[model samples]
Target: MPITPVKSTKLYHLIVEQLKQLIQSGEYRPGDKLPPERELAQRLRVSRAPVREALVALELLDVVEGRVGDGWFVKRAPDSSLDVSSVEGRPPSDILQARVLVECAIAEQVAAHHDDELVVGLHQAVEAFADELRRGQLNGEADRSFHLLLARASGNAVFADLVAYLWDLQNGQFFRLVEGMTGNERPRLERYVREHRAVYEAVETGDAGRARDAMRIHLEGVAKDLLDS
Candidate 1:
């Protein structure tokens, strides 16, 4: 069996696990409304953001149901532990694999469907990248913003959210690891701008084939570099 690396616990994920245990242990039964966010935050001694994120995550897991203007209620108990520690400790290789799968598909979708808002968003992202790059202050955020715009341009909320989450993971963990290995950022910044612009131009021209191809090549190159590093 392959070894799984030990992971740091995320505050929100810990909140999620604790709440799940409470429900599974019969402290919170099905149909039992959970306390207000403030109450849970106070009880857990954590900020409200973790509580809110945990609730959203729980709803996704179908362990809790949220009723409008009412509150969250225990919907069902988890049959097994809901561990999100892997997400916190996700390796760069895993993140790149996901990006190549999802972002490449999104590139085609964005090119097929033309929306004024999406076009503008893409342009704005490109501009942001360029500005940041020139300022010598660019980091992973500029690159992440560009890809996120493409994900949003796909007009799929689920895909967009997934892309955003992947970027957060990449920026928080993978990028920092890369930066440590490559202390000088200037070379990477130039290459990132060029690749981002290539993707934007392909999408702007409504060339689905080129857009898909460009995204695949760029992400594949990124995967290669990270793996080789």
Candidate 2:
């Protein structure tokens, strides 16, 4: 009798791992068409469900695009020429526009409904971010968490979730852009800390308009720096 196959792992995860390896190894080069799901399942000796799940996961990473009628195709490699310089990666103009649209709306909602618990959580997150900054480990996670806390404190779950998703999507490139800046530009970091403090103060005072204004000003400075370099 053939030896029993190991049943220790979830099939979807196994499929995902195998597919990831194939992509990484260049076996599935960018812009190359992937085999049909049925063909892939047959070759991998797995069911269609696992293969489908793997494809979905890859799509989330922008690695593949699913055409309406055609099979899944690899995405073109990201442009290397894109300027990701800290002040350039997210054009200050674009960042300002996004902040005005999203954050201002969040501030209005938060002002309408105050919550002591959420405020406390925001304070804790800020403290943790400060600690990380002092330790010289201003990684993306801490930076994101700090902003996420403020978004949540605004008493709008949808706004918080949206901001979190955007942060996750852009953080790697954002960090890379900032990393290229010279030491003379280190003052930008200090300015960011102060800006965050001002927003927190406005929230503490229950001044929604002030909070919105503070956030707008902070993002304006960020945009100016991006244009300066």
Candidate 3:
């Protein structure tokens, strides 16, 4: 028998490949729940990070579904006629618009119903975002965290999970494309810092309308930049 060569790739990608193969081979059927992340990681003899990332990738492909408070399950077979990944491949501007709609509403909800505990968490998220900015980090995790924290403060797990799903969709390819098109990234990052602070302050003060406006304006600006750049 001839030997096949493996190409170098990220560990998460390799995990995704194996999981996809499992789905394709019918070892896992539609609606079948997969092993827990830690169990998968232990079985595969790898870190849980790669397993979690792979599950996210699979979910994007619509081959799996992640239900809140429940484990991940196979949603569909790879050979299904549905092209869910194409839906996932919508333009970045479209995603940003959807984000603006959801997140702006979340900002309103948080401002309306915030307590001392939620306010404290929001403050911590804001400080974390600022610290990342001061360090000139472009990884975007802290920025995403700030937004995710706001969604969580909305008292809705679905909103927080949706925000995470959107962030996952903005992968390396998205960043590379944005970087190639935009030249004013530094100023834009600075602007994001300010806008985030504005949103936080509005929510902290219990100004619902102001919080909604702040979030809406920030996302609208992002949509414009991404579209017009």
Candidate 4:
């Protein structure tokens, strides 16, 4: 049950199966350390994205555990009923990457064509998010509004709906497993509000380049803080 390159597109489950089989066969005992993500991705001939996704899913399922700086370790042997495939839709990082593409474009477009009403709506979105944080809460819904409003401001129904669809998945089970890891702290959440406001400011000033850069920086921050070491 050694890890090997998998050709399937759904690599999250493949990684899960490989790890599960290894544990089941007594190759990895409880408390055994798993390979680093980089090494596993190299062996599997895939990027680290799916490997990280599978590891997080395993952590959620109680089969493994991730130590913030120390890396991942076996929590326990996989039970007969453990099913990684039961994980919903695309991985969280996958969704974030998609957002980086579409949302950044949306930001650029909205900024390029500034409208008074749109600016007001975006400011309200930013304020709503800040209000939730002020209450010492991590409000995902408030955060969702800003991006959706920006997309709609682009005057492209397709962009708005696509963003909405991605936002739906972003709030789903696949993303929830690691949600707190990114936004549980007052400082981190505050930083996110600032990031949102920065995007809003750029759009309000009609700075297309700055809007795109702000959005990209914000999403990159999420990926680094949530996904990477």
lDDT minimum window of 10 residues, candidate 3: 80-89
Give all candidates' CA lDDT scores. 0.81, 0.69, 0.83, 0.84
TM-score of each: 0.70, 0.60, 0.66, 0.58
Over 96-123, each residue of candidate 1 has an lDDT whose tens digit, in order, gives: 8899899999998898786767888888
lDDT per residue, candidate 4, 122-163, as tens digits? 899899999987886675778888888889999999999888
For candidate 2, write residues 1-229 as lDDT tens digits. 2244577377886786677678777888898999999999999998898898888877876778889789999884423322233233454456557756787667655655657776677667666766766777655356577677778876668888777655543544445456667465446766777777777777777788887888788777866776666
Error of 1 at 64 (Å): 6.5
lDDT: which candidate is best?
4
CA deviation > 4 Å runs, candidate 3: 1-88, 171-173, 181-183
Instruction: Give the 10-residue window scoring lowest on summed lDDT in candidate 2.
Output: 78-87
lDDT of 3 by residue, 1-229 (tens): 2233577478987898799899889999998999998899999999999899999988988889988889999998877443334345677877887798889999999999878898998888888877887887777788888998899889899999877776666543266656564456778878988899899999989999999999999988877777775
Q: How are the candidates ranked when ordered by TM-score, highest leading?
A: 1, 3, 2, 4
Q: Which portions of model 2 show Cα errors greater than 4 Å?
A: 1-38, 41-92, 169-172
Error of 2 at 103 (Å): 0.9
Candidate 1, superposed: residue stretches over 4 Å from native = 1-17, 24-27, 33-86
Model 2 accuracy (lDDT, Cα): 0.69
